[model samples]
Target chain A: MVTETSLSPIATFHSARRGRYEVAHQGVLALGEGTIVVEPGHNFEQGLQGLKGFDRLWLVYLFHLNQTEDAPPVMVKPPRFEHKVGVFATRSPHRPNPIGITPARLLHVAGRMLTVAQADLLDQTPIVDIKPYLPFCDAFPEAAVGWGGLAPTPYRLLWSEGARERVAEIASAHDLRLDHYAEVQLQLDPTDTSRKRIRATEQGFALDFREWSLHYEVRGEAQEVWIEQVTERPEFPGPSSLK
Target chain B: MVTETSLSPIATFHSARRGRYEVAHQGVLALGEGTIVVEPGHNFEQGLQGLKGFDRLWLVYLFHLNQTEDAPPVMVKPPRFEHKVGVFATRSPHRPNPIGITPARLLHVAGRMLTVAQADLLDQTPIVDIKPYLPFCDAFPEAAVGWGGLAPTPYRLLWSEGARERVAEIASAHDLRLDHYAEVQLQLDPTDTSRKRIRATEQGFALDFREWSLHYEVRGEAQEVWIEQVTERPEFPGPSSLK
Candidate 1:
């Protein structure tokens, strides 16, 4: 009947993926690389010895960006599936314990720093533990996955010339990754507005992202999604304005 | 620069493997089954919805039995490998965070309880998180493991009828799993005394287990190990006796 346990970070991950929206759903789908810097003065260097030989490593980290103070929702809608599933059945950060485990390809290890790729982690994410991936134990290619294995038809993402330029502009201006977010949210369930911040408009559909929105439309069999434009949402009066 | 995070257990695992010695190195190699009971009043039942559809699950748990108050050794010698490796390179419980993750075969999920098999967990192990195993993301059978992949010749374990009866007697009397402990410690390195509790005797080799010891011999090419007898150690004046 242990109530609680306290854990400290042994290292910090540095990645270009600065926010949750920028991270890929899976590490193998991540496009770029990241670095892990182990804290000093704890003899962690010795702990890292002989780790460079492994091709992959498992990182145990905290979902530090979880902002909700209340209990997490038991049911969550995963982007890949149509129905809402239990939080345990989905890889959602909002959990009883906001812990995440991801495997990254080991590129090189120098002193207390490790360079890895295909890691779907955010910038400055705290890493609590690291273990070399043992293929015989960790891998199970033939394992069954019920509803998850039967993936729905994925939408082929297509960005118009205007939309691509606008996305890049948003990335530079606000440090927001709308492109990656759109891919993660709209690729599988393009028309599902129940759980997504999407609504039908005169043109087609518009997905909201705080102060901005991305307008898109679904084509034949909803297999192709064309992001036509990105625009700033109209500002409205708030409590601050009233005050 | 986050300092620490507090985490509470969402569930507890019940298993026949009561101690670290009885548990296998990998879940797939474990002998028996276990049950995970999610704590009530947390809406965990809803959290477990749709988890049964998964064939396997990843359990994130704490190594509650790690007794050392001091910092863990940076390097450790794994059983399969001869040389010492980095703590991060092996699945040792003596870690900075003491967190462990293992994938187990899903048997059944009823209400807040989950029945799983081949779980290498101690009795009453606290489970912080559980996630359905997605083969597309979790599996990498072709991944490389450096020194770990080069497994040494394993010793075939053989027990005499007398020894078998003696082991059963000890199990009933002391409730200690000496048999499983011997298999884990001796099967890979039968005579490696550097890291294991093995000592050369007049007749053969003896492995210590508290007040008792198991005597065995390494046969031809060290490919076979024969457990001849299990006997109590000679009584000595311990610190408690002096006190």
Candidate 2:
């Protein structure tokens, strides 16, 4: 035997999507595209407006992707670890209670189409709760860098054939600049490797765009692109990656 | 006017110490040193034990300190941030929900006497719920490091008097390590600045204590000290510096 450990339940997450939200068991919240609505409601108007001003908000979503009938994993291979570290050290999707949170940006709030900046969730990823980023309260200035240092640093982006068009379209619609390195830094690579080496390689921008970071590799003049998908599973190819 | 933008809620914490625990609103909880035991039924026992194995556990406790008819702060100066930053940025004890979650470690669980590490809570700090660390799911390996870098680094204590003796006696009786830097990290400066600086100096050593890092630090030159009281806030007779 590998001498595995057992896990127990702690809490349940109540979640839902744009129009649907349910807290299933402890720490299990279900959310999807329909969870958030642009229309202002009595209990939600203030929160919605507060959410619009920021580029990104923290989604304290439940990790439904990791929920199981039996005990879930205590450790996971966090995307930042590139499948090399223990579960506890990484932010792998599989875990007990499966509660997950991500700082996603607000793209637009048109009536009911509450567009968001690059989110890793599917068309209907269940969202548990949303909190605005109070830059003062949320960001830890001197926090120590752990294995995340292994993630690619100095973020750079080399869009695929059609990815640039999509990004540009999204940027224009939102009146936000999405092409600069600083903009790209918003989505950090879990691996602290250099983007110049990977995107500049001959393979034409080998980039990895997950729900969080956008990693790229360049060869010769062509950029080898590997956009890390933002789903719970790192092995799963993203919609953009398929192209 | 500075032409400042009011983006999020602001709050202020009185002190980081033990007081009393009580239930307030429907979802709100209060933490105090006086009210230690809450009839968490026998069913919670299994769940509580599951939480003890982790290096850090999230305590979803109520902010009993802020009990009033007035609304809670829209922003807060997190104890770790000192008072320099806005309430939104720091994890101050005050908040709109009046809810607090401290990442603490489990030393041992003899019945209900849970000896925890990194418990910035006061003696008899009321614990509403305890959830173990599912490293795979909880750690945000790539999250940004904001003001944490600017905060002061914690200093090591070379005990001058019988502080070491007091710590030893308390630890032996309670099966606790009172003198470890982690304990001081939570107590010395219940203010966010002190916590931030201390965490910075030691690279969040308090966070490391739960994951076998405490054992390593205890083995080092730093001597352990016992806590004399968990109810009163220690006086720091200096001008309150903004973190």
Candidate 3:
């Protein structure tokens, strides 16, 4: 039998929020609120000294939220697909080894903090190691995509003036990134019900983000997400201004 | 303090050899011995079905050799530079979390055995997780490099007939991958003393790997690794045919 190694996190992440991250953004936004701040522990901050010179890095982290004291499941039902595939075949968090790896852009370094872009990890995730992204070694653009091939049909995000006003009110009260939410949920493919935050509506589709639900209509060919209505759940009271 | 998740290796690696990996081939050979077999444990093998459609993968593994029962170093002395840098700045294995991440090609898959290519890992390494390499998300060719920006100068590996024959014999007896050794040691920039397997010799330089010493001369521009001498230590017996 092989002996395994015990390890601890060298750093922790501070991000927008953490939970079941259903959006497989593919590390697309490597900047802004989407940016992940990697804070090196105590003496480990020096490791960030010369990292600013590199444009990219590999985030080796633990799948903290997915950890359980059981033999990981071999089969997984991916977001877009209905049939079960091997855990190795999919990037599902449920696995034999709860390790997460993502490629991120290193925006800048400040003291012990590193502002990075395009991270697929949850907030406060434990980092295992950081390696510079070597282009000649890591990139393979022409390679064929496995079962995850098709590009979601492009859909324009159309928000009415009233929809925008309502979202702004919700945003101010909740400190939610409603603009980013609109882009992430409505822009990618609003008509694709398989995506997170998207659901069928009487006239079109409804997008969900935390306490807010956005009602939108899919125009002809599902090419546009025409946001028609915006509302918050009564359970969570809105600002007195909204009342 | 934040709580960390405990992880276990899902599959074990079976490669040419194991132990201290003194070479970093950069997955340049992503085609041969560069190929690695990934055997999913128990029912996990079923997870790999239909993965061949993808061209690349991410290998998350444990740095077993660098593990210890003590605090990890925050400062690291990398192979290319002598100065101590932040543990996060360098890809040194002596990290707080001894984890290794490598991007590789998916050449083919047969049953439970997957022939993955271009990994910079040691034999029998414990793989924690495997993810498909999604090109649109992972590759960043134009990304800037920090202290590791400069690419090593190219060098040609020239071996005399006798040297080749001698290596063939030694390789046969000791089960060494001589071609891999020559390619890694020769193809990389020879002038950079920061690389592994290099030492100053009386005339030029000596490249060391495992139990053998290769004497080579670098030309005026340090552009060639002319292997003129090949000898094994008397302690390590050679094939009788060599006599």
**The candidate that achieves the highest lDDT relative to the unseen native structure:** 1
- How high a TM-score does candidate 1 get? 0.84
Per-residue lDDT value at A221 in model 3? 76
DockQ metric, candidate 2: 0.04
Using all chains and alpha carbons, the TM-scores for the candidates as numbered come to 0.84, 0.37, 0.82
Whole-model lDDT values for every prediction: 0.83, 0.36, 0.67
Worst 10 residues of 2 chain A by lDDT: A1-10
Candidate 3 chain B, poorest ten consecutive residues by summed lDDT = B234-243
Question: At residue B119, what lDDT does model 3 achieve?
Answer: 72
Worst 10 residues of 1 chain A by lDDT: A234-243
Give lDDT tens digits, candidate 2, residues A48-129: 3333455545554444444443544433434333444433333445533344455554556543335554344433344434
What's the residue-level lDDT of A83 in candidate 2? 40
lDDT of 2 at A218: 32
lDDT tens readout by residue for model 3, A1-243: 245556567677777644443334556633343444444445666666777788888877777766653776688787557787777877777777777777787777777667876776667787767777877677767767878644455467778999899877876886665655676556565677876557887776777766677888877575877888788755544443220
Best by TM-score: 1
Q: Tens-digit lDDT track for model 1 on A1-243?
A: 677888989999998777676777777767678999999999898888888678899999998887344688989987657789899988898898989999899999999999999888889999999998887778888888976654345577899999999999988987778888887677667777764478888999998887778999999575899999998778633323211
Candidate 1, residue A81: Cα displacement in angstroms equals 2.9
TM-score of decoy 2: 0.37
